[model samples]
Target: MKLHHLEALVSVADAGSIRAAARLLQLSQAAVTKALRELESEQQLALLVRTAGGVSFTDVGYRLLQHARLVVGQIERASEELAKLRGDQAGKLAIAVTPLVMVTFLPETVSLFRKQMPAIQLEIFEGLTAVALPRLREGALDFGILALAAALTDQEFDIEPLFAYESRAMARRGHPSAGKHSLHDLLDQNWAVNFTPASYESLMQDLFWQHGAKIAPARLHSTHSYSLMLELVRYSDMLTVAPEPLLLTESMRNWAQPLRLDEQFGTRRVSVISLRNTMRSQAAMCFVDCLRKVIRTRSRSASEANRMLFDRLELLF
Candidate 1:
């Protein structure tokens, strides 16, 4: 019913218990309990069910909690927006980016952004499209730098393609799959895949089939952590499909190299994805501009650079 009501509800869901939720909200346990009761009384529905361990949302509770998260996130962003507009130069932004972006030009991008708005807060999550989409929908992220094939046609998002990069099958330098110029050489090796938006297995299958090679890896491990996926490949015989430029880093280059296949993997565009029709705050736009500037400075795109996208976006903001 009220901002605190929604905040209380969302906090409980995240913290898992009344006392912990109270701590998170910086309110007393009794205050949080009263707020929850007030919200329930007004809604004429029970939003949470008690459990010995903590609390779990009922089916209806769970459904409403999603809305609660969206509302709370909006309130927070709105506050940040108001502050930035007032020339306070203080705001918060959260974004999810792929491992490639996280390790690559992001450092330079952040440096550029912070110089202009040093007080702006940043929360950066290293993740793929699979991890980013849910958070973006919930209003938890201002935008996401996600790896996607082709241009985005999804009506749910406003996609701004930044640059193109290739994915490669990588393994430890001396791994049997390395230096092999044929896809068939990888058929018998172990494989690990980082969690991407689409099913990596089916994607790989399509790749293999295109080349007239059928792959049945000795083992397949799907990992949530990109670092773990790389580590899996580095320490063991497991081969991983990751951004080709990932191996350009000193740490990765020391232990891993891309499989020298005759058939190069297709290029994927790394784009900024945000909820459709939603206008970003000024601070968010500044951050995006920094990304575009860095992309141009670094010249990372595999395809011919298109200045139109960047120019249009900057003019819009």
Candidate 2:
């Protein structure tokens, strides 16, 4: 089957409607349907079933989409390699990013990469772990950065552990618990939580529950945006859990108070994830290498500092 037919199937599966897929690909709805029929005929298997919700993939259709992604990725990688061999570091890259890490991390990384390799083209799409992982598998993104574990059951992805960071409870600068170190003291106040149920939000709640503590539904619940949560903290005594990297920014430091728990909650691993079976595109490899270098440098320094701090604490003890 033609690559366009595969592209149509993947786009339909992702967009979840023939109309939506047609809009995305700038094609007529009839054209999209024809493409699907062509793909099914070539594969001798049905790829999609239409229902009230839209076009959904059949079991065989899902498997075909996976193979299609690999094929398309290989074609792109071959082009990138040829470009590199011609001494031109030129190709397009698509990245899926989350807001917490996306704020300063990716912009800085992309800027630096562009300075060194001016010919490279870049595109960034903001999405959460739930949405980004599927797109990465469908060959919609060259790489993804997510704050979840590596063992994804449905997708064949290679995860490179970047760094582990801790999430802490944050409040206003002069809040009651600003000087407090006890978890009990903080929980007594109204909460400003940063997640929804059955996802990141629920995961945060579960982490605390696992540690024998529980929080009531927040007076305010948030997604990933810290600015809104920071505003809530400033105006009221609301406390929300925030990743250290995001909270440590200078903008929030003046008004934000970090509340330390006796037991660490919300320790998360961030990683650079890519499809395993796809041919490694030159642009993809270069970007991954840049991420690894950045992580290694930061982690090594952090490790050394930790060792030194431990040695000093032992002496005092």
Candidate 3:
């Protein structure tokens, strides 16, 4: 099928009606309908059925829709790639960042990315693994910085690992469990955990198992909202497992204390992921580069401080 045919099909699938798709493409509804007809005629299969609201994809149509999405997405990326090669500072990059990243290095990444690609537009939003994966598949998002239980395996996406995340099981200062020096001692407390469909709850279970316990907290609550989870820990007896970066935020640094457990969590990671076999435009790479630079800068600062302390101890000896 022609580019316009695939475009029309993709638009209709997204916009739900020929009329609305026309609005999106800035074309007449009749032109869109004509394109769809030409496509179906060539395929020799009925792709869509009319509905009172608009149209619905036929069984085969549903399968074809994915192909259309990929083709359409590739074309857009091709255009961006060509523009980038020509040294043109245009086109857009859309990315999703998890809440942990937002509170930590996002501002630095944004500033650094803009210094490299000043004219490129950026669209970023808060999303977790569940919201990000499907959008990545649909070509709705260009890049994602997502939290994962570990490095993702061979999926439809290419993963560039950022770092292994360190987590702390924490509670409000003066919490009874805060002073408990072993996971076994805190086992009876209620806990609020951050989890998504991608299964970060397993991280909590792993926390106990790593500490030589076989079970999770006595009472477990799962929440997707970081603020909600933190507030629960602050106001109530609920403790929460949070990324170490989250604990460094101004509000949490003052209000929360890490549970004095003998056991630490194993590896969870935050990484940059994008659709595989697709062109990564210059702007997208620049953003990833900036993210790395910020992480390095932060790491170096911490290392230098440790070095200074070590040097002081050398003089003492």
**Each model's lDDT:** 0.76, 0.68, 0.77
- Residue-level lDDT of model 2, residues 111-214, one tens digit each, is 66776668888877765665676678778788887766323343577776665566677778777678877666555677655454436545654446666666
User: Which residue segments of model 1 deviate by more than 4 Å?
Assistant: 38-46, 179-188, 196-218, 262-265, 300-317
What is the TM-score of each predicted model, taking all chains together?
0.82, 0.68, 0.73
Pick by TM-score: 1 or 3, better one: 1
Best by TM-score: 1
Where is model 2 more than 4 Å wrong at Cα? Answer: 13-29, 39-74, 83-90, 97-107, 126-131, 148-156, 176-206, 216-238, 291-317
**Per-residue accuracy of model 3 over 192-256 as CA lDDT, tens digit each:** 87555455555545666556665553477766666777789999878777666565566587888
Error of 1 at 6 (Å): 1.9
- On the 0 to 100 scale, the lDDT of residue 177 in model 2 is 76
Question: How would you encode candidate 1's per-residue C-alpha lDDT over 1-317 as one tens digit per residue?
Answer: 89898888889988989999999999999999999899889989988887788878888787777788778877787787777667677678889888777886689999999998788889999766666777787777888988876634889899888767667778888886566888777777878874453665546644667778776643566677777877788887788777776766655868888887887667677888988877688878999899878866655345332332232221111
Estimate the Cα RMSD of every predicted model relative to the unseen true structure. 5.2, 6.1, 5.9
